[model samples]
Target chain A: MTNQQCGTSRIAGCQFTLHPMSDNFVDIILSALDEVDSTKVWKDTDDVTTCVRGKMVHVFDVTKAIFLHAAKTGEHVAMSGTFSIGCPGDNEADVYMAESDEPMNLEKSQTIDQQAGCKFSLYPLGREDYMDKIYEQIDLSKARGVEVSASHYMTRLDGDVKDIFNAIEESFVAVQEKVSHTTMTFTISANSPSNK
Target chain B: MTNQQCGTSRIAGCQFTLHPMSDNFVDIILSALDEVDSTKVWKDTDDVTTCVRGKMVHVFDVTKAIFLHAAKTGEHVAMSGTFSIGCPGDNEADVYMAESDEPMNLEKSQTIDQQAGCKFSLYPLGREDYMDKIYEQIDLSKARGVEVSASHYMTRLDGDVKDIFNAIEESFVAVQEKVSHTTMTFTISANSPSNK
Candidate 1:
């Protein structure tokens, strides 16, 4: 809650909106949000969205809880969020990246592990060879010891927080030069309960 | 830029952060932001992120321009954003959803048809039968006239904006009743220039 409580601790922040397909969105959102652990995180809501801030574990925990809770209405709920950590001067988000010296235990990483992953897509404006560029970046990521899964529409990456981010950058820069129109969207977590 | 300009317009809002893979993040962010059209969209950046508000087309245009401009540095740049169009009482984002009566041209929708798509993964917490739950959701989506691609780690859905979202909700709710925890992350857009 306070900078002192989060002092040097790795914190994370996410802004999300829940879209209920069958109406009753307000009910679904309120009921789900009620389950969140306020002790571990901070939540702010407007008519359109909700923003949650806190430690990485708590952030992920509350997000998943609210989402699943909302889904219970069986109304086709779609929760979209943008999450981040490691932003400089972002006092609340600093905890997650503050202690970057620890190496991830790759051997023990699994769906059940308290690990995280990301799925993203790069849209290159007016370029016919976007795949080529994406591949180049993927190759660069492989060189950096990151694991990536590439499909026709997007790229999925999972591994150490540092390595995965490194791969994303390498891949992003690979195609950034030829075009002046590109858009990339991604979702990340500090601690993923499982690899879905 | 003003409330009047956004009146009755189907606009959208996205708050995003660009993580450049290398050390020159400041330069990349600044240059890309400069390319954005202030005439059409309103862009505000704090110490942590940038929030862009405007018409859907303009928002997409400015986002692409910034990403591409930043990518020119040939550094890995990952952009994370939360975008929405139809939330009650969110006047600014209402434009994109206000005129929802117009049907989408499904026949002309293609990879290059100024179309958009999204890929997302659902991580179910503390559950051994996660796949079963995911399959249940997928089945619910299939009944709704949507196309889905399911892999070991994630689910890929693509189609009309309405249908895609429909499928997302159906799929999301399918597993909501279980005693497990779940998290879903996704990337979506209305118009995409290229597939990467």
Candidate 2:
């Protein structure tokens, strides 16, 4: 079900769960999301988790805003998220991976250089050409100026959280188009602006 | 600095940060952690994140307690964690991975299902004998009743989270003894007792 919305989308996305510790945690999370500019992001929440699909900019913006809002209380909270750039059935195909791109937000992209890092693996699960597809996404990430450190199984990406997530989306989405059973798992961390 | 405290450790550990979406997030998270049976889990918090190190059971117990406690608030909170089984100079050695073991917690171990799952990869960087070490660990994990699903870069383990972590620790520690640098990354999820 590829909607036209995929055309404007460049980055893949993240599915996250926010486990609030307060008695009124739900109210806090929903309100924080409401305060962000979620124009290009698609959001859906169920009992287990919330999925945010969109460009890298909107996802990180919302995530950062949410963290900032939540941590301001100085209460204990936790978030679990899976960020991916590609998988089969992505609607926003290749918007960010294109050779030439319009600056989605020049100011945000320029000054947002706090490092966010992640290690992820794409499991194509017995696909013969999985390596080829995996490399293609890696190439796309490199093209977008992301620094990738590859290992035997997972790749580590270090850079701006926005750029890193963008690279993740682009790579994940690129491979998703070719593989049906691929599952990507990521553990990501970024330096909190408030903590800094 | 390897300390004497590492001898009592049965499993490797992780340090994590929770990003909440509310101002009172810290209160919420700390309260949740406090509610758990956090006997030996060493906890240290700075402005950026909280670090927890201890045996596998306590660490996972605290983590689950925190997630459940926080999620109950039904507000969005996010957590980022680094789970490691072995690194250079780990003192715990092969306590958990020992072929025949005293049940660390027989009651908890007995009630625990055999379906815990984790996907992990050991990144040896440029180690020449990386493949051999990988297989050795794979063989060791199989011996411990871990169902291993292998791929080009990573391996998937289906069994007890404790067993899985044990396998992870055993494998990681094995290679660490031989090589100076190796990092293992894992995505772990278990059937939540509280959730059920």
- Candidate 1 chain A lowest-lDDT run of ten: A1-10
- Residues A73-182, candidate 2, lDDT per residue (tens digit)? 44444454555443323564344344232333444434444454555555442254444556555564353555666421245665655576566656656666665434
- The residue-by-residue lDDT of candidate 1 on B1-196, one tens digit each, is 0011212233455555554433344565667666544455666664334566655545545555555455445544444454433212235433344333222222222221222244444433334444445545545435354556532122445555445545544444444444223334444433221242
All candidates: DockQ: 0.02, 0.08
**CAPRI-style grade of the A/B interface in model 2:** incorrect
Return the lDDT, model 1, position B135. Answer: 48
Residues A63-181 of candidate 1: C-alpha lDDT, one tens digit per residue: 65565555455443444454443222235434344433322222222222222355555544333444344445445435355556542123456654445545654554454444333
Per-residue lDDT of candidate 2, residues B1-196 (tens digit): 0111222224455555554455566676677666555555556554434555555545555554554455455444444454544332344434333323332234443443434445455544224444455556445535377777642223556664456667766666666556444445444443322231
TM-score for chain A, prediction 2: 0.53
